[model samples]
Target: MAQMTIAEALREALREEMIRDERVFCIGEDIGIRGGWGGAFTVTLGLEKVARERVIDTPISENGLFGVALGAAIMGLRPVADVQYGDFLFNAMDQVANHIAKIRYMSGGKIKVPLVMRAPVGATGRGAQHAQNLEATFLTIPGIKIVCPATAYDAKGLLKAAIRDDSPVLMFEHKLLYGSKGARSESGAVDASSDIPDEDYVVSIGKGIVRREGADVTIVGTLLMMHLALQAADRLAQEGISAEVIDPRSLVPFDWELLEESVRKTSRLVVVAEGPKTGGIGSEIAATVSERMMDYLTAPIQRVASPDIPVPFSPVMENFYRPDVDRICGAARKTIGD
Candidate 1:
C-alpha cells in the first residue's frame, strides 16, 4: 500500500493502461512536453518517459483536439483527451455530443468509441467561465458515460475503468479535489490524497460508494460536494443526528439500486451540488428518486445547490454562491425533520 495524491493516482492509471494496452494513448494540450503543466493539473506529468509517441500534445484547440481523439477512437485506438477546464467542453460539444456520443448507436453498434475526456470542474474562485459546474450540460446527452471521482483511490480505479470501457467516457475531476501541487494548485483545495494499494484494481463504473453510513438521512453528492457532505455528516454526528453520505461516482449509468436502497433505509434524501438548481444533475437525481421511491421516503427530496446566477467574482460572494458544509447540513436536517 502507498499514499498518493489524486493527480498521482490518475497518472498511475494512465501509465498502467498504456503499458497494458498498446491502443491506449493520451492526446491533449501541453501533455507530454518535457516540462509542461501536464494537461493543466499535472495528471499526465512525466508520462513522456515510457510512451512519448503515445502521449500526444496538441495546440490550444478543444474542438480540434477532441475531433482528433474521436477519429482515433473510431480507428480502434483508446484516446484520453484532456481539457484545461470543464467549461471549455462547450467548444467541442458537437464532436463530443454528436459524433463521439452517437457514433456507436448511430452506426448500429458497429463502432466503439473507447475515448476518455478528462476535465477539471468546480468553483475555485476562477470567476464565471472556469468556475461553472458543467456536469448538467453533459448529462443531457446520451451514449457517453460520466464519472466524477472523489478520492485518490477512486480516481485511480474509476480512471482505469473509464479507459477500459468500450464507450466514450467523460471524467470530470474537481479542481479543488485534485490536490495538485506547485503553481497549478487551487487555493481552496481539499486534501483529497488517500492511501492506495499497490495491487491493481478497478472500481466499477456506475457504482456509488458509501463514504459514511447513517440513519437520519442520505446526502447524495459527487466530486467536491461529496467531500463537503462527509464533513457535514461529521458535524451532524456531533449533534446526535446521523447522516449518510453517498458519492455517485458515475452519473450516466448511475447506481440507482444502491441509491434507492439508501433512500429506503434513511427515508430521506438531500442532494448537494455546486451546479445551478435549474436543470442541474441534482434535480435529475431528486426527480428520479421521487418518481420511483416516493412511498419509501418520509420527507421531500431536497437539493442544496448554487443559485441560477453566474458564479460571482468576489471571493465573499463566491463562497456564498457555492454550497458549503453548513448548507448541506442544514438541508439534511430539514429533510429528516430535525
Candidate 2:
C-alpha cells in the first residue's frame, strides 16, 4: 500500500492508462513543459517523463485545444484535455456541447469521442472567475458524461473509468479536495489523501456510495460539499438526529435509485452544493425527489447552496458564500422538522 494525494493518484491513473493503451494521450496547457505548474494544480506533474509525446502541452487557447481533442477522438484517439479552471469551460462550450458531446449520436453510432476533460472547481478565495461548481452546467448538456471524485481513491478509479468509456466524459475535481501541494494549495483543504493499492482498480461510474447510514434524514452532496455534509451528519448524531450521507460521484448517470431508497427510509431529504441555489444540481435532485417520491418524504425537499452573487475575495465572505457544516446541519434539521 502507498499513500498518495488525489492529484498524484490522478496522475498515476493517467500514466498507467497511457502506457496500457497507446491511443490514450494527454493534451493541456503547460502540462508537458519541463518546469510548469502541471496544468494549474499539479495533477499532471512528471507525466512528461514516461509519455513525453503523449503529454502534449498547448497554448492558452482552450477552444483550440478542445477542438483538437475532439478531432483526435473522432479519429479514434483518446484525448484527456484539461482546463486550467472550470469557469474557463465557457470558452470552449461550443466544442464540448455541440461537437464532443453530440458527435457520436449525430454520427449514427458510426464514431465515438473517447475524450476526458478535467476541470478544477470550487470557491477558494479566488473570487468569481476561478471559483465555480460546474456540475450544473454540464448536467444540462445531453451527451456528455459527468464524474466528480471527492477522495484520492475515487480520483484514480474514476479517471481510469472515464478514459476507458467510449463517450465523452467531464471529470470535475474540487479545489479543496485535490490535496494540491506547493503554491497551488487551496484554502480549507481537507485530508482527502488516501492509501492506494498496488493492484489496478476502477470505481464504476453512475453508482452512489453511502458514506454514512442513518434513518432520520438523507443528505446528498458532491465534491467538497460532500465532506461538509459528512461532518454535519456527525454533528447531528450528538443531537439525537440520524443522518444518511450519499455521494452521487457521477452526475450525468446519477444513481437516483440509491437516493430514492434513502429517501424512502429517512422520509426527509436535504441537498447541499457549492453552486448557486437556482437551477443547480441540488435543485434538480430536489425536484426529482419531489416528483418521484413525494409520498415518501415527510418534509419538503431543501437545498443548501451558495447565493447567486459572484464569489467574493474576502476570506470571511468566501467562507459565508461556500456551504459549511453548520449550514448543512441546519438544512438537515429543517428537513426533519427539528
Candidate 3:
C-alpha cells in the first residue's frame, strides 16, 4: 500500500480506468493543457501523458462540454466529464437534469448512459460564485447518482466505481480535502490522504462507512464536514461523550442500514453538512431518520450546517459561514442534552 492524497488518488483512478477500457476518456476545460493546473486542483495534473489523445482539453464552455460528454456516452463511449468548480455545473443544468439524467429512462431501459461527472465543491474563500456545496442541488435530480468521498482511499475506490457504473454519476469532491500541493494548495486545508493499495478495487456505491464507533451519539457528515465531525468527536471525547462518526460516501444511494444501526445504538443523532441548512443534505438525513427510526431516537436530531446565503469572500466570514468543529461539537452535545 502507498500513501496518497485525494488528488493523486483520483488521478490514479482516471489513469487506471482509461487504461482498463479503451472507450474511457476524459473531457473538460484546461484539463490536458501543456501548463495547466489539471482542471482546477491538480486531479488531472499529469494524466495527458497516460493517453494524450484521450485527455481532451476543451474550450471554456460548461454546457458544450456536458453536451459532448452526453453524446459520447450515448454512443457507447464512457467519458469522465468534470468542471473546474462545482458552481459551473449550474451553467449546464439543462444538460445534467434534463437530457443526461432522463435519456435512458425515456428510452425504456434500453439505453445506458455510463458517464461520470466530477466537480470540486465546498467553500475555500472563492466567494459565492465559485464555492458552493452542490450536493443538495443535484440530490433532487433522480437520474443521477451522487457520491462525496472524504478520504483518499474512498476517493479512488468511488471514482473507479462511478466510471464503471451504467448510470450517470455526479461525484462531489471537496476543495479543502483535495490535498493539492504547492500552487494548487488551498488555505486551511485538511489532510485527507490515505494509504492506497496497488491492486484494483472499487467501493460499492451507496455503502456508508463508520469512521468511529461510540455509544453516546451518532454523527453523520460528508466531504469536508466529515473531517470536522471527526475533530468534533475527539473534543467531545474529552468531555466524556462518545460520538460515532459516519461518512455517507454515496449520497444518492444512501446507506440507510448503516446509519440506522448507528442511530439505534446511540439513540442520539447529529447531522453535519457544509451546505446551507435549508433543504440541505443534513435535512434529508434527519427527516428520513426521524420518519423511520423515531422509536430509537432519544432526542430530536440536530443539524450543523451553513446559512442559507451565498458563501462569503472574506476569510473570517467564510469561516463563520461553514460549520466548524465547535459547531459540530455543540450540536452533538445538544442531542445528548448537554
Span of 10 residues, lowest total lDDT, candidate 2: 30-39
Q: Model 1: residues >4 Å from true position, as ranges?
A: none
Stretch of 10 with least lDDT, candidate 1: 31-40
lDDT of 1 by residue, 49-95 (tens): 87889999898889989999999999999999999888889888889
Q: Which of the predicted structures, 1 or 3, would earn the higher lDDT when compared with the native?
A: 3
TM-score of 2: 0.98
**RMSD of each candidate relative to the true structure:** 0.9, 0.9, 0.7
Distance from true location, Cα of 94 in model 3, Å: 0.5
Better of 1 and 3 by TM-score: 3
Q: Model 2 misses residue 208 by how many Å?
A: 1.1
Clashes per candidate, residues 3 or more apart or on different chains: 0, 0, 0
TM-score of 3: 0.99
Report lDDT (CA) for all predictions. 0.91, 0.91, 0.94
Q: What is the lDDT of residue 203 in candidate 2?
A: 88
Q: TM-score of every model?
A: 0.98, 0.98, 0.99
Instruction: List, residue by residue over 288-313, the lDDT tens digit for candidate 2.
Output: 99899899988988899999988998
